[model samples]
Target chain A: MQQCYGSIIRRQRHFIRCLGGDRCNNSSSDTLLLLNDNTRMQSVMSRSNPAIEADALSILRSISPTLDSTKHKGQAGKIAVVGGCREYTGAPYFSAISALKIGADLSHVICTKDAAPVIKSYSPELIVHPLLEESYSVRDEDRQSVATVVLAEVDKWMERFDCLVIGPGLGRDPFLLDCVSDIMKHARRSNVPMVIDGDGLFLVTNRLDLVSGYPLAVLTPNVNEYKRLVQKVLNCEVNDQDGPEQLLSLASSIGGVTILRKGQSDNISDGKEVRSVSIFGSPRRCGGQGDILSGSVAVFLAWARKLVDKEGHTLNPTMLGCIAGSALMRKAASLAFEDKKRSTLTTDIIECLGRSLEDICPVG
Target chain B: MQQCYGSIIRRQRHFIRCLGGDRCNNSSSDTLLLLNDNTRMQSVMSRSNPAIEADALSILRSISPTLDSTKHKGQAGKIAVVGGCREYTGAPYFSAISALKIGADLSHVICTKDAAPVIKSYSPELIVHPLLEESYSVRDEDRQSVATVVLAEVDKWMERFDCLVIGPGLGRDPFLLDCVSDIMKHARRSNVPMVIDGDGLFLVTNRLDLVSGYPLAVLTPNVNEYKRLVQKVLNCEVNDQDGPEQLLSLASSIGGVTILRKGQSDNISDGKEVRSVSIFGSPRRCGGQGDILSGSVAVFLAWARKLVDKEGHTLNPTMLGCIAGSALMRKAASLAFEDKKRSTLTTDIIECLGRSLEDICPVG
Candidate 1:
C-alpha cells in the first residue's frame, strides 16, 4: 500500500494539469524507476564516509530549551513553511506539522488558495494561509500584481517566524517560483534562516545567488538533489572516494552555506568542517521523510542560534541544526520501525518524534 | 483489484471566485493566528462554567433502532457523502463507509468522475456515483449545461437519501462547489437533513443562506473552522472564556441551525441551549476523525429524528444526534488508542466504530 501510495504521489504530484492524463502510461518506466531507486539507495549508502561522526546527542541537549513554566508560547520556536499547491498538499502538511510535533511552539503553512483547505483539513494545529497564486489560476495581465500581492501576504508574518522551511510540496511552476524567489529575497534582507529541501532545492540549485554566500542558509539535498547540485555547482560528477572533500568544496563554492547531503549516513558541510551523523534509521524508504527532516532542521536551527555563542560554538547554528535534526529523525524512524515495521509511514515516524527528543534530552 | 479516475476538467477554476477571495485566509494577520489559538485552547481546557453535560449514553440508547428480521435494508437510513476530488479520495470513503458501519442501510458517494473509481476501490459497500463535474473539466461555454446535467444526476436520488454528509475530501473547486451549492438547495427543498463537515463547512460559512434557518441542517466545525464561523456570523473573535455562550449565539444567529463545535470536548448547541459531551476520547490527533464524526452524526441524526416526537422530545433530533455521535466516536477513538497508542490512524478508529457501537446498544 505504501509503494502504491508512493507511486500515487509521483503520479499526482502535478495534479491540476494531469487530471485526465494516463495513470498507467509509465508502467515500464515506473518499473525501471523502481529498479533505479534500489541501485541509487545502495549507491548513496556506499558514498558517505562515517569517519568524522557528529556528537549529535550533545548538540541536541545543548541547543534544546528547558521547559520553563513562565515562557509564553512562541518563545520555543515559530516555523513557517512556504510550499503546498493545487498539485501537492501532503508534503507541506507533513513538513509544517512535523515542526509542531517536534516541539516547535507554532507551525504555519503559506500555500495556494486551492491547497490550503485540504492541508488545513489534515490538522488544525498548523496555521494555514491560503495566500499564493499559480500560473493557471492567474491572468497573464494580472501576473505582476498577483506576484506583488503574494509577496505582501508572506511579508506580513515574515519577521515573526523564527525560520522558514522552503519547499516541501512546492511544485515547479514558473510564476509561483518567481513569487517565492521574491519572498526569499525579502527573507535574506531580514536575515531569516532558511532550510531548503524538496522542490526548494530545485529552485535554489538553479538560482545559486539566492543562497550563495548566505551562511545562515541550509540546503538539505537527497541523493539525486545532491548529484544535481554537485554537477551544477562544481561542473563535475560526484566522486564517492572523496565524499566529504567533494561536499566541502561544493559548500565552499556556494560560499559557506551549509549543505546536509541526505543518504544512508547523512553528511554535513559548511566549507569550514565536515560532519556525518551515522545514527540508525529505519530501512523503510517511504516518501515524506525529507519533509520531516526539513521541519526538524528549521526548529533546531532556530534554537541552536539562540543558545550557541557566536565565538564559542564549535559548529555553526546551521550545522548544529542539521546534526541534531538528523540524529532525532533517525531515532524516531528507528522507534517507529520497531512497532509498525513494514507499515512504518512518515506519519508513524512523526508520532515518535516527541519520545525520541525527550529520550535524547530530558526536559526539567 | 482497484478501479480509479475524476474528470470533467478546468473551465475557469475558482469562479465562485477567490477574486476578493480571502475566504478562509486569516483576515487577522497570520502571526496573530498563534496568539489567539494558544490562548483560546488554554481557555477551552480550563473553562468550568457548570455547562450542561449531555447524557450521551442515554441519548445513544434512546435513538438507536432495534434490529429485526422484518425491517428492510433502506428502512434503517440512507446516507450520501458529497465530496472527493482528484487531490483527495480518503475522506469521502471514510465518511460513506463509516455511515454503513454505524447502522446506515445504504451509503452513497456522489463525487467527480475522477474521484469515483478511487473511492469505489476503497469499498464496494458504498453506492459510488461518478456524476459530479469540476470547474476544470467544463469549459466556460459549457458550464451551465454541464451543471444542469450534474444536478439532474444527483436530483434523481435526492429524496432517496435520508441525510447527506457534505464535504469530506471535497476540494475547493469553484465549479464543483457551485454544483454542490445547488444540490444543497435541492436537499433543503426536500427537507432532507444535512450534516455539513470538512469543506462543506467552508462553503456554508461563506454563504450561510444554504443552511441558515433550516432546523435540520447541522454544522460540525473544528476549532479553526468554528473560529472562522464565529468571526463571520457573530462578527467577532472566538472568546474561549464564554465558549458555550458563543456557540449558542453562533447557532442562533444562523436561525437555530445546529452547530457541533468540535474541540477537546464536543460542544453542541441549537440556539435553545448548549450541551457538552465530555466523554474520554483518544489523545491521538489523526486526520479523517472529523469525517467519521460527520458520518456518524448523519446516521444517528436520521434515527433520532425518527424515534423522537418532534414536538415532545426533551432534545431536538439534531442535538440528540450530536450527543450520541460524539459519545460513540470518542469511545471508539479511546478503544483504538488503547491498542494502537500514538500510531493510531483514522482507519484504526473506523475499525473500532462497529465494536464500540455494539458495546453501547447491542443487537438482539
Candidate 2:
C-alpha cells in the first residue's frame, strides 16, 4: 500500500508539473530538465488507461519550448546522427533530413568517409562529417590512432548536440562500433540524451555497459532489435502475451534508460511503466521508414529534454520524446499513405511532417 | 431507343476499358491510348449528364506506375506540347512545363523559333524545340515548304511523345494553325494521342476532320470553346440543363473523341456516357489554371493507358483521365488558393501540382 501510494503521489506531482503555470513558458534548460525528470516519474506510475496517453501528449506540448525570434540558431534543437556507412547512406540521410524538416534548428550527420559525400549529395541542408573509419579502411597498426581521432572529433560536437540519434545506417564494423561505443560513453558523461537504433542496437546489445544505467539514453529498437535486446537483457525470448511486462523488465534492467519498441504500436517505457502509441500508420512496409522515426525521436527528445530542464519539471524527457515522435511519425505516414497508397515512400511521409504537426497542434 | 442503347453499350464498353478490364489490356497504347480514344468518342457523341465524373483520383493512383530505382529514365512518361508563339509564350510554357513538375521523366515543348529562346529562358529543365513557323516569318510563296519543314520536324519527335498537348500560347495565325493541323494529322496517323486546348481548340472547331474519327484525340475547351463546340457539333446552343447529355452526344458525334468542358465542375464525356469531376477547386480564377489542367490530362492519359494495359481491365481510360486530371488540377488550385489567397497566380498553382499529386497518390 505504501509503494502504491508513493507511485500515486509521484504521478500526481507530474500532472501538476504538466499544468505548472507560467514557468512552462521559459527556455532555460533547468526547467526542461525538471519537466523531463517529473514526466519520467509520472510515466513510471501512470500506465493503466488511455488518459495516460492523453497525459503524454499534453506533457509533450507543454515541454516543447515555443519557437521564438530572440532564440539563437541552435536553441530550437541541434541533432546529430552517429550512423551512415557504405550501402546505407540513405538511412542516415533520411534520419538527419527528417530532423530538419520537423523544425530542428540544425542537424548534423557523423558518418564514415565513404558515406559522407554520398549522403551530402542527397541534400545540402545537412552537415555531413566524414570522420569515422570503417573496418575495411582501418589497418591493424593504425586502429588505436584512428579510434582516438574519431572519439576526439565526436567529443568536440557532443556538448552542442541536444540529442544524438545513434543508429539509422551504422553498419556492423568492429573498429567503427568500438569508436561509437566510446562516443556513447562520453555523451552519457556529459548528460546528453541519446536515441539508439539500427546498427547501434547491434553494438549496444553486445556491450550493455554503454547505455545500461544511463537514464537519459533511449533505445529505439524495431521488432528484431527489440527481440535481441529482450533476449539478452531479460535472458528470455519475446513473450507477446505479456509485452508490456517484458518491456518493463527490459527498461528496468537497463537502469531506467528509455526504451521505445517500434511495431504496429510503439511501446515506450523507462523501467517503471509502459505507454503505447498505436495511432494510425500506413500498412505499406517500404524500407527506410524507420530512419525517419529515429530522426524524429532525436529532435523531439532534444526539445523535450530542454523543456524539462527549463521548467524543473519532474518528468522523463526521453519518454515524452518517444510519445511525441511516435505520434508525429505515425500521423505523417498516415497522411502520406492516404495520397500515395502503396507507392508511399519514406520521403513522401517526411514531406507531410509539417502539415501533420500543424493539424495536431496549430501554430497561432 | 435503339440508337440510345447502342451509344450506351459503347459508353459502357469504354467505361469498362477505362477501368482497366480485359478487353483493352493488350492494346499498344495501353490505358492512356484507350482514354484518349474514349475521349475522342465522347467528343464525337456529345452526350451530357451533370453527375457522372470519373473517379479521377483513383485512376491517377492506378495509372501512376510505381517508381523503382532499377527503371531508367524515360520509362515513366514522355510528353510534348505544341504551342508557344511570340505573343503567348507563357501559355504553351505552362502546358508543356507542368508535365515534368508532376513526375513525367521528359517533357518537350515544340514552339515557334521566335518563342524558343524566351520559353527556354523560363526553365532549363525543358527540351524546347524551335521548329514551328509563324505567318509573319514566312512569305506566301514559301508557305508550303515552311509547313513541310515544321511537320517534318514534329514528325521526327512524334513517335517518342506518348501524348501531345496543342495550343496554349498558339496565336491566331492562319499559317501556323494550318501547320498544326498537318502535325495533328501525322500524330493521328502514327496513333499518337493529342490533348487539344487554347488555340488548338479554335483550330479543331473549324476543321473537325483532324480529329473526326481519330479515337486518340481529346479537346479541353473552356466556357467559350465549349459553346462553340456545342454550336458546331450539335448545331444547337449551349444547354447547361442537359450539359452531361450534350457532352456525351458531342463526344459520340465526333467518333468517340473525348471532350473535357472546364467549369465549376469539369464535365467529361465520350459518346457512351458522361462523368464529372466535381472535386473542390479554388475560386481564384487564375489565367494559368487551364494550362495546368491540359498538362495534367496528358500525364493522366499516359498513366491510365499504361494501367489498363497491365491490368487488362475494361474501363474508359478517357473518363478516368479526365477525372484524375480534373481532381489533381482542382486540388493544386485549391492548395495554392489557401496559401496565396486572392494573390494566387498560375505559377503558384503549378507548384502545388506536385503536392496535390502526392496527396492523392503517395510515392509509397
Question: What is the per-residue lDDT of model 1 for residues B1-364, given as tens digits with 9 covering 90 to 100?
Answer: 0111001001011211222223213424322322344433233234443234566887898889989899997999999999988656777888888899999999999998877766777777989999888876789999999999999999999999899999997878899999999999999999999999989999999999999899999999987789899899999999876677778879989999999988777889898767778777865555678889999999999998788344345678999999999999999988986665534557778999999988988877
The 10 consecutive residues of candidate 2 chain A with the worst lDDT sum are A45-54
User: lDDT tens digits, residues A1-364, model 1?
Assistant: 5685365435323321232224323556434433455433333234423225566888888887765323434677889999999999999988988787666766889899888767866753566777888899999999999998889879989999999999999999999999999999999999999999999999999999999999999999999999999999999999876777788889999999999999878989998777778778999999999999999999899999988355456788999999999999999999999999999999999988877876887644
Off by over 4 Å in 1: A1-203, A213-217, A222-256, A269-276, A282-321, A332-364, B1-46, B86-88, B171-174, B283-286, B308-313, B338-343, B362-364
Model 2 ranges with Cα > 4 A deviation: A1-56, A308-314, B1-364
- Candidate 1 is scored at a TM of 0.65
lDDT of 2 by residue, A41-64 (tens): 354344442113324456556656
i-RMSD per candidate, Å: 8.5, 11.9
lDDT of 2 by residue, B1-364 (tens): 5576456455545554543345333434333433555544453345443243455676778877776433434556789999998898998888866787676766788888788767765653466777788888999999998888888878878898889998899888999999999999899988888999999999999999999877778899999999998899899998876666677778989999988989877888767656677677899987878998898899888877767364543456666677788888999999999999999999999878878877888775
Query: How far is B43's C-alpha from truth in model 1 (Å)?
Result: 14
Question: How many pairs in model 2 have backbone atoms within 3 A of each other, for residues 3 or more apart or on separate chains, i.e. clashes?
Answer: 122
Residue pairs in candidate 1 whose N, alpha carbon or C atoms collide under 3 angstroms: B5-B114, B6-B113, B6-B114, B6-B115, B7-B114, B8-B137, B9-B136, B9-B137, B10-B136, B10-B137
